[model samples]
Target: MGCAISGLAAKAEFGERNTGDDAAAPAAAAYLREDQIQMIKESWKVIRDDIAKVGIIMFVRLFETHPECKDVFFLFRDVEDLERLRSSRELRAHGLRVMSFIEKSVARLDQLERLDALALELGKSHYHYNAPPKYYSVRT
Candidate 1:
């Protein structure tokens, strides 16, 4: 996926710094209280089952709002039809990968250092794929 965890970067330690427009998430998540964390974990339970579907929908919406973002994914760069991507095996696979990262990220929330490190690695990997943090957060 683009930048693994959009707002999880440790300052500018991640590959790219998000622009003002890209600063969608608050860093406050890093300071979430135990009760808040528990609430998030509980909320996630309902969404965990449809992780793949959520992943697909998230990307579809991303591409819809930011078509240029497709250039970051070789498989989608030349495709002119957006609807067809819905059933694309490649898209589905990538979606699953993205969702899997989110699942793991959520699982590690209680372990902030581990979660930050995970996001750090993924953010660093984005440079290799030319995926910028800009595409990580899109307006819906």
Candidate 2:
């Protein structure tokens, strides 16, 4: 199944960030709101040990909800089954790494440069994958 959401609908709901370009996320310093910080810390505290699973679930749900996203991954192109997909080494490794980065993002929320550097690094990686931010539309 492809994404159930239309472009218009996604934009309406996730309009906080603009992903159409290579530029940094607007207001990067103040990106995480007070409430969001509390929520992130609270949630991460609970799921910290299972971040790998979080990553796996995130990608699995992404592909399940927007099947076309699978096309972005050469390794995952032929796989549609979530269980098998989660079991793939590449999926597991990448998922864990991403979740680790997310953990850092949350941990260094007060230190903008650390998060900025990470974003730049991730942007370079994403460019290599041919996945601009618009493709994700900020699922977080």
Candidate 3:
């Protein structure tokens, strides 16, 4: 009940929308600042190859932050040993594959179609995992 969002669409109440505030609405832009883009590109280069490791750490941290999250993964659902789960080959494969797709998404951010396809694939996987949209946000 405390700000739990569970859907794909974000819902925020900032008073009424469609209240003839057209002039106050900001324009959306496709172009990112060159410096920011370059910084992201350069930063990503350092960690791109070790995305699997990154993914592993990220999951570990997520579970650490909220142990309940481990329940979402059937393989790790009943894992009694955190270390064992960390070294799990199945977990490694899944984490690596997911990370690869994320890396691909970043690399292809300029391609809207590719991003959309990746999102669609994620949505399907989420359905199977029973992961709420808020779970993907990692802020729940």
Candidate 4:
């Protein structure tokens, strides 16, 4: 499948990790350039308040694009009408929770070590929920 989103993670070789090659990896310190960080910060300021809406849109797109992903979300698995989900209270609540995490991630960007730990914990949480990284990524 063609890439749809820049910078967002994508499954590598059908979700199977490729062998690590240090030469292909960017230096950790240069991962996010100062100008990139500034751009992200400025963009965050514009949408921070609308994160709930953004979250809802994000998940809605996820479900629509990859119907199989619904199996990972018990509450949404049986949902038949994607349009109706737009007004679902449960969905709104979940959206808030997801967006809140994004907010925290943005806030901790400068603290890479802390952010890394936070991400590790999040992956563990996903493991407990039986949601694999493949389900979190977009596919076509």
Candidate 5:
């Protein structure tokens, strides 16, 4: 899915124009309410936690199901191995970085400008893995 900001901007820029009172409102107007912002922040906390938990669980399960991936983990052979590849110090730093991003994103979920960038980076990092796309579909 697209980031919230980029998705909104793209829609405002290229989508068909509204033809009524809605047309007079700014494209971002829908996102400016304090309540909406709060909601987004709350939602983001849930989203961030859910995604992180799901990611970790999935990684562990993948390795359990296919022990060959253990070597990949030690070698940073793919995105799934990032957690294992870093040194203790590097892992600490990376953890902090990830937490900071998640906190910031949760604080300002309505302004989701970096999500797409994050997704792209993840996709690139995972590209070297030869597993079929369907491999991700098999749940533990």
Candidate 6:
């Protein structure tokens, strides 16, 4: 299944067209499809928005449920950085960045590459807090 999806994605032409005004247009035409691309574009937009909403809700709920974790985030915060992240625009941009990564992961659900990377990052971050993996089981 994984191979099949990868193969399909590789072959799928996301029809984007060029008006031939630029010299680089020919190179850009290779991966750009104009017609069937709408499905992918719309699907990603929906998934990204949904993930952003869910991520915000979960972040709030998580902070509420485990107030202790707030200290972890605060540890990395400078006054300016904290204030920047607290702004609505900055927060939304951060959310969208995270959501885009998540949307790509979901789109490649047949592969474990993103999942492994996510786990590795989490493990590394956990080490910084001196958190044992067993703490997750305890929380659950």
- After best superposition, candidate 6 residue 30: deviation in angstroms? 33
Give the per-residue Cα lDDT of candidate 6 at 34: 46
How close is every model to the real structure, measured as TM-score? Answer: 0.72, 0.69, 0.67, 0.73, 0.32, 0.39
Looking at candidate 6, the ten consecutive residues that score lowest on lDDT are 1-10
Q: So what's the TM-score on candidate 6?
A: 0.39
Cα lDDT of model 4 by residue, 97-117, tens digit: 988887787777677777667
* Candidate 2 per-residue lDDT over residues 20-60, each given as its tens digit: 64233332434455676677788888878888888899989
Model 3 pairs whose backbones collide = none
Clashing pairs in 2: none
Give the C-alpha lDDT of model 6. 0.47
**Model 6 stretches with alpha carbons more than 4 Å out:** 1-47, 50-53, 75-98, 125-135, 138-140
For residue 125, give model 3's deviation from the true position in Å. 2.7
- For candidate 3, write residues 1-140 as lDDT tens digits: 11122111212222223424433332111123445446766788887878777878777777788888788888887887778878888778878887787677666656656765776687787778677555653321
Give per-candidate clash totals. Answer: 0, 0, 0, 0, 0, 6
User: Which of the two, 3 or 5, has more TM-score?
Assistant: 3
Please tell me which model should have the higher lDDT, number 2 or number 4: 2
Query: What's the CA error at residue 36 for candidate 5, in Å?
Result: 8.4
Candidate 5 Cα deviation (angstroms), residue 44: 8.9
Better-scoring candidate (TM-score), 2 or 5: 2
**What C-alpha lDDT does candidate 5 achieve relative to the native structure?**
0.48
Candidate 1 vs candidate 2: the TM-score winner is: 1
In model 5, what lDDT does residue 57 have? 50
What order do candidates take by lDDT, descending?
1, 2, 4, 3, 5, 6
Off by over 4 Å in 3: 1-31, 133-140
Model 2 lDDT-worst window of ten: 1-10
Model 5 stretches with alpha carbons more than 4 Å out:
2-72, 75-87, 128-140
